[model samples]
Target: MKNFISVVVTLFAVSFAKAQIPAGYYDAATGLTGYSLKTKLKEIVTNGHQDKGYGGLWDAYKVGDLDKFYENDNTILDIYSEKPAGPDAYSYTPVTDQCGGTTPGSEGGCYNREHLFPQGFFSSASPMRNDYHHVMPTDNVVNGKRNNYPFGTVGTASWTSTNGSKLGVSSFPGFLGIVFEPIDEFKGDVARSLLYFITRYEDDLQTFNYSDVNNPQDGSKNRGFD
Candidate 1:
């Protein structure tokens, strides 16, 4: 029964025609290194990545939110959950396809797209706002709590998600400010998405409003803001 249940849930998720990078998409990136390799890789992703309109994400989430263990019904497939295998972060009974709700009172209210790097940081411009790599499934209330804050280690908790995620001052190196802190399990996933943003947009990164990148802020065409 357990295996049967997992199969059913996974099928539900896979039923969506999930967008994906094309085969041989990275062929051009082969044998490349550092700046040159990264540049080609950027071209590959930027050119191949289909820009699913911002509104097309409801379908996307259904496909992506399948990792939650079947045993944990309605529990978020949250990286912040200390008990990712079972038991919910909070009292959640997932409302089917009920993502991006206008107002969620708490954890289980609904899920929404969480911009790991934050779209506002880039001024909510095109492509960047709709990039699926940066946009991910998250509990509605928890997503709201994250707001537009950057992610980093938290020292004092201003607030805590039912799953135990927290928002507070930064303890990460080279910066000090309010930051969202997810569980350790999700750190690598978040880091990769952020790196993807830098790599894929390397050609136009400097144009974005944020100064986190090491590029010149001259607003050049290759400014990396796209």
Candidate 2:
């Protein structure tokens, strides 16, 4: 009985420690309750950008003009710049012609901007929309396969991107873990982006697939199980 009690206490302490958020990070305001938070997120996404071609979806992949997208994406770059490592740390140029021998317009290569936190799950708002933390260049078809599926680790992935940059797993032990390998230069940035998504969208988090009840503070929930 004494041994059991000790083990229980130890587990509780570990869980408590894991639940603590990092200092100086964003926390949902108590007053920003219910849909108010959602509204605020949307406002942040659409305020400055011209909506001429801005469809409701966060379709970075479908933007008709790359230059226009870059012009609008400046706001997102600003947000990313304020983080610990900052914007330049997370930015990268897609190998424009390097389709890995895959044909142009093919699903394999042809670089695209991918949303780490899928747009399909949320209404796709600003801050969320323009936030550079979760947005990055990736292959097209792989992005579709990922399509708002919760991140997780899988013993076997159902799909693999042509560039070998992204893949999807069938199952994981904890938190629907999705394993993402970014260019070595941006791994930290991707990790931070995931952390940011969990905290910023905590209320709507359950709306998307999640492996655990704990919020972003505990990386264990929605963590890379592998």
TM-score of each: 0.73, 0.41
Name the runs in model 2 displaced over 4 angstroms.
1-109, 162-171, 174-187, 201-226
lDDT of 1 by residue, 64-183 (tens): 655545444534355554355456644333446356436867566666778776776678887888887778777767788888777779998999876568999888776667888887
Task: Provide the lDDT at 91 for model 2.
Answer: 31
Question: Top model by lDDT, which number?
Answer: 1
How many steric clashes does model 1 contain? Answer: 7
- For model 1, the stretches where C-alpha displacement exceeds 4 angstroms are 1-24, 68-76, 80-82, 90-97, 211-226
Model 2 superposed RMSD (Cα): 12.3
True-structure RMSD, every candidate: 9.4, 12.3
**How well is each residue in 1-226 modelled by candidate 2, as lDDT tens digits?**
3342333233323433655834522243224533344334334433464432322323442342222233344322212122223222233233332234554454533445567776654556554655544676554555555556544444555554433344454354555555543334445445556645554454454455333332223332222211
